[model samples]
Target: MNTILKQFLLVSSIYLFTPTVDAYSLNDSLTKGTAALSSATQVKGEAQQLVGQLQSQLGVSQAQAVGGTGAMLQLAKNQLGANTMSTLSGNATGLSSLLGGSSGLSKNLLSNISSMSGVQSAFSALGMDPAMIQQFLPIVLGFFGEQGVGSTLLGQLQSLWTPAK
Candidate 1:
């Protein structure tokens, strides 16, 4: 009876003292989840600021602002190539999110807009006049300028966006 009691005590102590693997893994997962949520929130806030600006300045709806900005960014991506667009996106917060698949428009739709005419059509599809693209351009350029985009890149964007006479 004495030996059995000692063995039971030793087993109980071992179980009590041993650290749980699940606890450490759960903590790590929670930390990662929190960081990811924070990053997503920051991106959403930055995009919201731009969307708010577009809505107030252009008198457009939230969907219009997102779709228009997405259209323009999609055009820039098509014209500038992935590396250049990556640089541009790095300079501007939430720029990538605007062009991301989750932005109001679908990935397939954004990928389809490779030119100014395509942008205009996208604008039209968003219930905005195609000419509104002109208004959106200046505001978007100004926003990029404020975000510290280089003049050379800005010039390239301007040239790409400007309608030919």
Candidate 2:
């Protein structure tokens, strides 16, 4: 009975004293998540500024700028791989609302816009002038360049800007 009691006490002490193994890993994950979210917020701010630039430059309504910009971003997203798209989308807060809010309009607008001509078509379909498409492409690409998008993705986006014939 004495030996059994001693063994039980030792086992209980060991169990009680064991350190929590998950605490460090969980904290690390949280730190990474917070950093990622912070980056997304910064990118979102830059995107909003670009939208403002579009509105002011084109004399279009806010809705037009946001929607058009969203469509353009969707075009780029379509060209990227799944992981890149996820990172891009996750980092932009304005994307969700500008993409037409879960309705089919956004998807439909993006469906036809696979290239430069498609960009003009999509904008024209949205009631924007075809002439303005060239102007908007540089603005969008310039904004992304400022935001530090890599050459690969930026190049992909730039390819969508064939000037009006």
**Model 2 regions lying over 4 Å from their true place:** 1-46, 90-92, 163-165
Residue pairs with clashing backbones, model 1: none
Candidate 1 error regions (>4 Å): 1-45, 103-105
lDDT of 2 by residue, 2-86 (tens): 9999999999999888766797576565444323322222224446778788888878756557656765666666555456555
**lDDT per model, in order?**
0.74, 0.61
Residues 29-113 of candidate 1: C-alpha lDDT, one tens digit per residue: 6444323322332235466778788999989977678777877888988988887677766766676666644533255557877
RMSD of each: 16.8, 18.8
Span of 10 residues, lowest total lDDT, candidate 1: 34-43
Model 2 TM-score, 2 decimals: 0.58
Which candidate comes out best when scored by lDDT? 1
> By summed lDDT, which 10 consecutive residues of candidate 2 come out lowest?
34-43
